[model samples]
Target: MAVSMVGTNSLYTCLDMIDKMVSVNEGYIAKAILALLETEKCVVEGAGAVTLAAIMEGKLPELQGKR
Candidate 1:
């Protein structure tokens, strides 16, 4: 299980993701990922905090396995 966000497109856009961060009473977290790929348009990657998607802070490591 890889712990990170993986994408092929050149998503080079960073905005205020504050609103995207949501908290649940069940002790779970969620965030929205908006990226501007080279092709244009915006891509949204919404994942839970426990998943690798939440920890995808530009630098993704251990592509073969989880950290």
Candidate 2:
């Protein structure tokens, strides 16, 4: 419906700005959370841990060996 479409403008805008998209499953998210909690002593929620999950799982190959 026209009314529901209003909220998706931001999603469209974001899509315009990105060149690539990647994803990780719940297991990867869980592992990232455990790694953070054990190694960094930090408590983070699933959404907050997603980027690190992608990195830890090698989803972002561009970041490899870049310090």
Candidate 3:
């Protein structure tokens, strides 16, 4: 399970809206951060990079090509 400093309301909203959840390790998070920096010229913190990490790790194949 993942816990965050995010607000309860935001957590509640996410719980209500999301159909699935996936977990990625620190290595994936680090890779994601580097990927964003290297490819998109963007820098993101670990928590902010998790979704991309999941996608990169093939944990969310269903989300491929999604908007």
lDDT of each: 0.34, 0.81, 0.86
Tens digit of per-residue lDDT, candidate 3, span 1-67: 3666767887797987888867798899999999999989997899888999998888999988887
Better of 2 and 3 by lDDT: 3
Query: By TM-score, highest first, what's the ranking?
Result: 2, 3, 1
- The most accurate candidate by TM-score is 2
Q: Lowest lDDT 10-mer window, candidate 3?
A: 1-10
Give the number of the best model, judged by lDDT.
Answer: 3
Candidates sorted by lDDT, descending order?
Answer: 3, 2, 1
| Per-residue lDDT of model 1, residues 1-67, tens digit only | 2436634343233333323432232222223233322223545334333333333442234443564
Q: Report how far residue 21 has shifted in candidate 2, in Å.
A: 1.9
Query: Compared to the true structure, candidate 2 yields what TM-score?
Result: 0.72
| Superior candidate under lDDT, 1 versus 2 | 2
Better of 2 and 3 by TM-score: 2
Taking every candidate in turn, the Cα RMSD to the unseen true structure, in Å, is: 15.8, 5.2, 3.5
Candidate 2, 1-67: lDDT as tens digits: 1134444777788987878767787788999999999988999999878888888889998986676
**Which residue segments of model 2 deviate by more than 4 Å?**
1-7
Q: Which stretches of candidate 1 lie over 4 Å from their true place?
A: 1-32, 36-42, 48-55, 58-60, 64-67
